[model samples]
Target: MATDHQGPATMLDVAAHAGVSRATVSRVFTAPESVAAATLERVLKAVEDLSYSPNAAARSLRSGRSNTVALLVGDISQPFHSQLAKSVAHVAEDRGYSLLLCDLDHSMDRLQRLLTVLPLQGVDGIMLATGDAIETPGIRAAIDAAEAKGTRVLLGSAQPDSSMALTVSPPFEEIGYLATKHLLAQERWPVALLSGFKGSVVSTLLRAGYLRACLEAGHSEKETMVLDAGFNSTSAQRETAKLLDGAAMPRGIVAANIPIALGAISALADRSLSVPDMVALVACEEVQLAEQLRPGLTTAGTDIGVQGEAMALALIDAIEGQAATARALVPHLTVRESSALS
Candidate 1:
């Protein structure tokens, strides 16, 4: 059977090309695990050869679903967000759903606009990986509107709150506490937390953890420092430089994330300061390049993949008309050369 090159290929064309029934082709797209491996392979090959695409509009009409999910993140370029996106996308694909990845670009305005657009576009569900501005009233209004339009929503990096939507995230406060404690255990005094925006939920939680560690060491809140690093490398670098030039220098530093850690490392290098000897450094999350650097990064990290998978499954449960629940993954400290005491 020959498919017309001028128009789009259909399921029947794919079935003819693969020498299978139309139902077999449908099974290949919908429930592939039920099909024989060889038959699945043949149908996939036929789909590739004919460039066959399922008619989404017809499918939507038949199933009353768009079979698509949207993912919103503050910054996809960062290590933690990127890793989470990858894990969510993998799980979404396996569940026979398409993922629409949206970058908020660190803008509340953009997030608001996208919140409106996604429901309008008929995505079955939404997963927001919010790193900042999680408590804005405008965002809550947008989410309410989206839910009113019948789009299920899930919030990543969120705790169990009154809104009652499914939430999945790492234990941010614990990460902060453990990272700071790792430095304190080495007898590094006056440790500082190079953090994200001050008022954001993540920053606040991490600060709480930092304060907890400080108090445990018999240090008051005034004894420790918390600098706003603005959720990026450049800001982190600038703040770190100021800290280094101050009268009372910190013996240990807890960078909020990998990019911030990189920035702090750059600032230390500019001052010709040796890591671990002059100032021990630790990051709240681990990245792939952590170990490859001059000295391996000491980090407090959780399984990003596990968190993402949980988030995806929670959203899917809501999309399928089931009750979803909140989950928080635990974190652990990884000691490395950067935070080692000489």
Candidate 2:
């Protein structure tokens, strides 16, 4: 018996094994409908036997388009990102486009890697949800490179440079403004804002909006209250306890997000402080956990599901070569017993 030697297979190998031309093999992978059934079957069998995968770049070069989109988010575990993923996936599936998820975790280095790999992997467009400012040079270069290639890039949540294509994010500023204004309207003049990370874009906007409302209401700069809780429930809880223990606690609290709101609620409960009696509370995001709590939370936000849907729709439009425009989705305030005074 003679020893057999195998070498790495190529498109030529598949074509030879299938008894077809290299063009036929390429057609079978790129435009299967153009090839006959018998030829297609033979090419597929050869592909499997040789363990040959069509190079996506070559295929895109031939076909002129790739049916895939990339979605980059800050935190995959967060409810808001999870919801957005679901919505974007549904929309992509309906349009016969595939979605590639990339979680940047707010790391510019990670985002840079994604930019390098995404277009090479044949992504037709990109939807970025930075959740915070992305100022790194590498990440900026990647985004610039993708745009230069005519790859549609739609930014969500965080506003990118005006030169780059971006979609509008949820009205985070309005969320803070309305929540604080609502509290002030209810005679909660001294309102304390428990915000997320100091560097977060949403947090900065929300804090600014809160300050604007306070200033408009004739509240002095000295009386304006704010705390940067650093994006953790435990920290918010601890800060809430400390604030309450201070000489003069605010009558109301506006938490930037759901986790912080939950923490604030826990802190209040630990001290046996009744909501809306000792201190009223409102949050930026509405989570089911809030509703299940006693005196259900008064939130100036809508469902994450809605935000996800809007993001998906905008992404699809960008991918389809539609005009890049900002679309702001305002969250409505849902008044509940948590912020109501009896």
Candidate 3:
């Protein structure tokens, strides 16, 4: 076993095995253009046989570059974040860079602390998901400090400060408007929204878009209901029960996220009312679950993987001093069984 020295084979092991100096081995791997093709072949062979890997820490210390990108997502459990994480990891690894995925679970304090130290640790770039990571006041100084230390930053969502920072955003406001409009187009009176908690930037924007569409269609708040369940499926269930039990049920509902949509469907099932037959349903964002459900969910189809890759590329370009900002993704509605009138 070439890596038999115990933990892992070092670069020196490959160098020794290849009959070359450690510097030659390093040059062959890092600056192959400067190394002779014959030496490169020998080193590559030795690298394969010894299975030796370069230490990122040592390389960063020697070159002042980490060749790593960090992605901070608010919640990995969310379908959107999970997709974003997968794409970011894939692209980072493909580009010969290590990826650090940090799921903060929506903790602002933890994100602030992480931002504070990312520069000192020589992280090459950062990809931030929405919410406190981009909106919190503490993160600005940290971002500035990191930029001064040569760590580039990109955001996964659009915000008020988006013009100042590179951002890759899906068609957010349009998604809400499209989903709500689809519900309204069914001629379903008294529409509602399962739009997460109040004061959330995402939920707020989505709600505003929904409201804008409704108002334009001559509907008022009296005919529109916005329900809050803290973005939890179980909470949405309870809220749905209260909505059905205590008040008149809206003819149509728009779920701000896939989870909320699932919860809403479950709640409706509890009442033995079939989707679209009893009430129309649509979700602002499409996910895998939307299609797999009994009544395929009508949704605003936003490509999350594209959003993640766009941000990753933007961050990489920024790191390399190339100005790159992604274009906003336009969402298209996917009509399905759930929103059909029965």
Candidate 4:
């Protein structure tokens, strides 16, 4: 009679089947270069037969380095962040590294816990993308600890702190300035600013740029139009509706980001306003949805995927101590149907 008990296959079983030591099997999986080609082939064949996958934790314990990195973002659901994550994952795979993603959801406490756990789990590096300004003490401490452990950290679209390493994102002020300036060039004076969160760094810079453009165009203080729409579509729609209901509405509107642009379009539709006929609209970041809208949105933006790839490469360099300079990618404007006036 056959016994019913059967133990799961392990690295030792694969090593025995391949006629190699346990260390050789570990090397075959973790550091393939360290194993001879013939030996690696044998080990791989044995692994396939046994349906064995290497244990990442055990390999990291023996190798003193985890071939894994963590990407932390403020809002994972946002189109920009989702695209960035995909880009990073692709690059990480090319470099023989795995990526772990964590969404902070704009919570300081959750971000802190992620930082704490990532290092303990032997993550080789971290990429941080905060939707707003980076000002939390927990974030600062996490950066310091990662640096102390010789783990690389890269930040995108976040203000740099002297204590941590970073890659500068597209100049948000430039995005805002260019969007508003485009409206102004169309002979649309007194453009209204539909801003994001009050304290967000991107919002502050964009707002300042819009105001500066108005001043440069010789618009009076009262005529330098502005409105705070907050973030997200619902808030933007509500704020924009209020503006439409008011006694006066600006001839042009500058939305802080893509989501705001979508909301602004909806609000205008509700008021039976036509794009570039009654009012012109411009947005800071352009996504696919913008183009699919009834009238494509004009926007000032940089390639988010390219930025993500650059950030990953930069973080790898920092991790290996090869480079020490902060890098910045510039923004460019794209003209679309929404801003066209015929």
lDDT of 1 by residue, 178-293 (tens): 99999998899989999998657788889999999999999999888999998789999999999999999888999998889889989999999989899999998876668778
Candidate 2 residue-wise lDDT, 104-123, digit = tens: 77766556656644664457
Which runs in model 4 stand beyond 4 Å of their true positions?
1-63, 160-162, 324-328
Per-model CA lDDT versus the true structure: 0.82, 0.76, 0.76, 0.76
Task: Kindly report which residue stretches of model 1 are placed more than 4 angstroms away from their true locations once superposed.
Answer: 1-59, 159-162, 323-328
How displaced is residue 277 in candidate 4, in Å? Answer: 1.1
Most TM-score-accurate candidate: 1
Roughly what TM-score does model 1 have, to 2 decimal places?
A: 0.80
* lDDT of candidate 3 over 1-342, digit per residue (tens): 243466667778888888989899777644455677677768767865765546446444635677888998887788877877888888788777889887777776556656644554567888888543256566677677667767787777666644446767676778888888887777777788888886566787788888988998898877778889777689888888788785678888888788888888889999997788888888887677778887898888577777777878778877767777645677989888998665
Candidate 2's C-alpha runs over 4 A off are 1-63, 324-328
Candidates ranked by TM-score: 1, 3, 4, 2
lDDT score, candidate 1? 0.82
lDDT of 3: 0.76
Model 2: lowest-lDDT 10 consecutive positions = 1-10
- The deviation in Å at residue 256 for candidate 3 is 1.0
Model 1 clash pairs are none
Task: Quote each prediction's TM-score.
Answer: 0.80, 0.78, 0.79, 0.78
Q: Pick the candidate with the highest lDDT.
A: 1
